[model samples]
Target: METIVPDSEGRGLLARLPGRVRDLVQLARLDRPIGAWLLFWPGAWAIALAGRAIARWDLILWFGLGAVAMRGAGCVYNDIVDRDLDRRVARTAARPLASGRLSLKMAWGWLLTLSLVGLIVLLQLERTAQIMALASIAPVAAYPFMKRITWWPQAWLGIVFSWAALVGWPAVTGTVSAPALWLYAGSILWVIGYDTIYALQDIEDDALAGVKSSARALGDHARGGVAGFYLGATLLWGIALWQVRPEPLALAGLLPMAAHLLWQVAGLRREDPADALARFRSNRFAGLLMFLACFVVGTAT
Candidate 1:
């Protein structure tokens, strides 16, 4: 059987670009911008929710740069750690590190360069947001090892990816509150749900390589399990909103996001890898929809 290349992700441009440029693109995940957007949206939502209009644009811009830099750093770090495992996985086997397109030392150098860019972005934030951003370092450093120890690594990833909520609130309000905390919690559950769907794409490869993930843990019941996670995420987000504002209208904003989650879950197909990836990528839309809802709820008079 022939493998099909995704339209958005093929070896076309990378094959044409010079070595250094292509390597950098692979390290930065330029071919895959969804990860950066997923990391950025929650921070944007938190800023909008705070109604700090004066600095909102600045915060969003910095967080956007930070997301791209940090997400690149993460991919580099993951590639370094998973070099061996990645070689065994079909989809990831062609990754720069796994395919021998880039060496380990060069990858580390690239990682440091991206981290420096991330540091520059961090310096642009307020003292509190800077500190909040710094606090994520330990979690980010520790994430590559989570899969080796737990099937619920997706849970830990949620906690790490959603740290932007922590950063954004402090950047905007200069302090943490119950509302911001609830938003952070809700975002974690949302990450876990969506990332679990992503893991479904690699269940077979993961199992063969002795890897642990939510999809493999759930096995034949993966679709139903993902649905349950998405349902719980919606409920958690609703709880977060109620805690933050306690207004009936505030809860109404959650309805669309909840409905979207339901749609993703209902349409999920555990047996089809392509379908799983499509569903996973579609969460970018889910993130956007939720951010808009948060913005409306937070900024509305």
Candidate 2:
């Protein structure tokens, strides 16, 4: 019987499940929902920014569901691909596949099951949105190998995770526009910033395993690197807001989120794994702040 891993977020609930079920749940990362929330926000921002959120509320629901399923599938695939490397990282070593609690066949079955749920969500979108969503497959397939090839794998993750903005805009408006593009671009920066913080938790292990990440690349300058990425995200999001509503007050929508990102960067304890994990998790709230900004600017008269 496999016990809960150290990084699991829902240990109480996970503990009640049968051993195999618990392993599957952990394999899909269902125990930790921060990733799903992070994955969902870009699409939510896009829908709200497109000014059709209230009317197209269904898209939000669908995207939210899709985020959970697809993020899970992505995690399963990443685990399958990195199972060897995962064993080399203490934080990741106990993951189902890496720890030998789950077999490759079981992991593949879970991946397909999660992907089936994703397919259901994808079928709910309009043609344009569906096409846009399908286009993400190549990037998604390429992401697990990124750390092996580049220090900027977080950038590839940014690309993969921020793809919902492309689909959401088209889902709402039946066409992609400048606002969506800017939102996607800004979201990529945001992902890189937060994910760098996430990578801080595994810096030493990643180095020992020969894995590269922005956190390792930044070294002592990681805080500044995160600050730079956050700053760029804010500027791009401001530009996106301006594109939607050119009035001065429109840019004010970003103030709260900007302040939040600043707080994260200003107080970040780069060397503490706990602080790094806390800062990374706080992006869930940061994401909501940006969504509110997008909502206000997008829905304003």
Candidate 3:
């Protein structure tokens, strides 16, 4: 019984599209918009917390578009590089490239097409933002191979995924500030937490394949690992908030988002892949909650 479609990442009508179209959609993980949201929010938060988000709505929108395009490009690039490894991982075995539905040549072509979309978004930003965006390339390119060598590949992912914060701040402020740096650091921990949860889905497969991940590193304490990461994130976020407003009360802004992260830790079930994914996807809302907190604090009198 040969599986023809990538069931792990694609679903609903998107999964039912014509074979060619569906393959393209799933290749970019368009069916899972949570990745886009997760990528977009850190930039959005940086903008909102920089105090001109309402006025600079256009930058926010451009960053959102950039997230979509770049994330797609990243997925395509990763798939092309990891096609062989992917075939051995159950959840990724049916990816278009791994399943033989799409050739590596076509995958590279798709990656360039998506990168063009990202380039268009880059042109909308100032030189500083453009440079910041370009700087992310090396880390992004290295990410697919991190698992082959490191127990903390998620840490590398943290650096790659949280990069939008660097771009977002300079796009508006015209310079990277302390608050933005703190926010990016916090986002790194946040990414580590959620992505570790995501990696739980492939623990056995990753083990069989001899790949490494934070989830495997944490072992029986995976839940506690996530909790520790989330706690570090909260502390960094709180520090970022305080740097912006310098008011002790501004720290309270993190309460809702912090509580949400805590709830994720409390509800974690390492044995259940569905539960792990649910926890991972829940970061979309966690991102929103943090954005609101930043907006409220950043806009305060």
Residues 61-135 of candidate 2: C-alpha lDDT, one tens digit per residue: 999999999999999999999999999988888889998989999899999999999999999998999999999
Instruction: Give the number of colliding residue pairs in candidate 3.
Output: 0
1-301 in candidate 3: lDDT tens per residue? Answer: 3222233455678757898888888788877778989999999999999987899999888988989988888888888888899999888998898899987787888889999999999999878988998999999989999999899999999999999999999998899999999999999999999999998888888999999999999999999999999999999999899998988889988999999999999989888887888899999999999999989988894
TM-score ranking of the models: 2, 3, 1
lDDT of 2: 0.92
As for lDDT, the candidate ahead, 2 or 3, is 2
Question: Ten-residue segment with the worst summed lDDT in candidate 2?
Answer: 1-10
Residue 112 in model 3: lDDT: 90
Model 2: pairs clashing at backbone N, Cα or C within 3 Å:
none
Q: Compare the candidates by TM-score and give the number of the best one.
A: 2
User: What lDDT does candidate 3 reach at residue 231?
Assistant: 98
What is the model-wide C-alpha lDDT for candidate 1?
Answer: 0.83
RMSD of each: 2.0, 2.8, 2.4
Q: Report RMSD for candidate 2.
A: 2.8
Candidate 3 — which pairs collide?
Answer: none
- Give the CA lDDT, 0 to 100, for residue 275 in model 1: 79
Better of 1 and 3 by lDDT: 3
